[model samples]
Target: MKFTRRLFLGLAALLLGVGATMAHAANALDTIKQRKKILVAVDIGGPPYGMIDEQARQVGSDVEAARLLAQDLGVTLQIVPVSGPNRVPFLLSRKADVVMASFSITEDRKKVIDFSEPYGVVPVVIGGPASAKVASFADLSGKTIAVTRGTTSDQELTRGSKGIPSVSIVRYEDDATTNTAVATGQQDYIAAPPSTILAVKKASPSRDIASKFAMKAYPYGIGVRKNEPELKAWLDGWVKTNLKNGKLDEIYKRYFGMSLPPEVLQ
Candidate 1:
């Protein structure tokens, strides 16, 4: 049997393509195996999700979740405290292997990072003084709205509240500052995630603030590099396992003071 030169070249090219794909896959696996550590980016300012405690230790739902994930994978978890603005950049730069912050999955962010199956949902809320006449989003017109910088609350108030006129937006360095500003009348209202708002209210019973409005629910998930499909799949599998065995609910209640909502559990 005589092989034509053209056919020989085609076979060579095909073999090279397959070899390259295999090499790429192997390299990715090697990267994970060799390090034996998963770098997790978490917010140090968002309590009940990810935050730094008085002792300077990372502590919160996302932090605990990341620790469990690392334990399950038999790897060391290196927590890298990150601000909201830098979460995506850290993942892109390989400074972190995953983001376990309370990052709301958005179409815009999907362009930069891959999100695992949503592990929980956070409802948005508008908080203000109990004496305020504000009743809804419509009441926010011509009002000063305080929000943590680089958060989904900031994005939503800036983009979603288009119907409101003269809405002055105030950006704070962290959730605590944002909530405090509203409570102290430095801002008219604070747009924040419901869990954080509730936590703050609990911590400061004298604040006399009321969560007067609730908005669309935002799903929260872990983030990985956009190209790391395998890592994303593994994270989803872990979430499923935890949710099925009731561990997920336990974790939620421990941090948020409530069980996983039906929508999220289902």
Candidate 2:
């Protein structure tokens, strides 16, 4: 009888220990609320999404969205500049509470970080002068195309040009360089992101530069650490609420000069 009683007591103690561990497990929501600030990682080089403004400040649509998110949470927003390759790493290392660096949702990326539902969309399109004879991807059989190295636009255009003969590709380090190549006729066309391309087109209103065709589109999402279910749920709902309420649209239009595209809504 004494042995049985001791065993029961040990079992109770084990259960209590398990309960304590569960209760004390780290939770991003609790921590964020307690700290009163959410550190958002962003890249200042990704134009329209994140970039330097005329005042030489790191500002972009993504930065503004982060601001709105902080406002919704009634917390302070702390911006941490990160490069494309390091955004995910920053989140995993707890260097940032969230990442809003135009992080595009992809199947491969899902294996690493949790993405909030898409907050914005940017299309990858081939743009050029309207006077250019190119009508389709096939039409660019032997023509030169400009793209930033390591972008979806570069990957897709390169993949599509596999069998096409004499399809020259010029890879630049940045979107501005690609745009300049097109503007100077050093490149016949530029396969680039929607926002940067739009800004370029707007800059040269009489040049007839326009989106010739789409290569791909990406719905950008806010990123958080994996296993933070509460944080993920809250972030997703926050994005959905703002998007549905037209608040996200207002921010987009304020930066990019148009409402969110219908494709983005889908």
Error of 2 at 89 (Å): 3.3
Candidate 1 residues lying further than 4 Å off, grouped into runs, are 1-30, 173-180, 183-185, 199-206
- Candidate 1 lDDT trough over 10 residues, lowest sum: 24-33
Best-performing candidate as measured by TM-score: 1
Lowest lDDT 10-residue stretch of candidate 2: 199-208
Q: List per-candidate RMSD values in Å.
A: 3.3, 3.8
User: Relative to the true structure, how large is the alpha-carbon lDDT of every model?
Assistant: 0.80, 0.82
| Model 1 TM-score, 2 decimals | 0.86
Model 2 TM-score is 0.78
In the range 1-266, model 1's lDDT, one tens digit per residue, is 25688899999999999999887774533476578988889887777788778898878888888888889888888998887778888888888888998888988888877898888777777877678788767788878888888778888777767868877888987776886776566775788887666766666667766787776678889988866666777888998888888887788899877887787777
List TM-scores for all candidates, in order. 0.86, 0.78
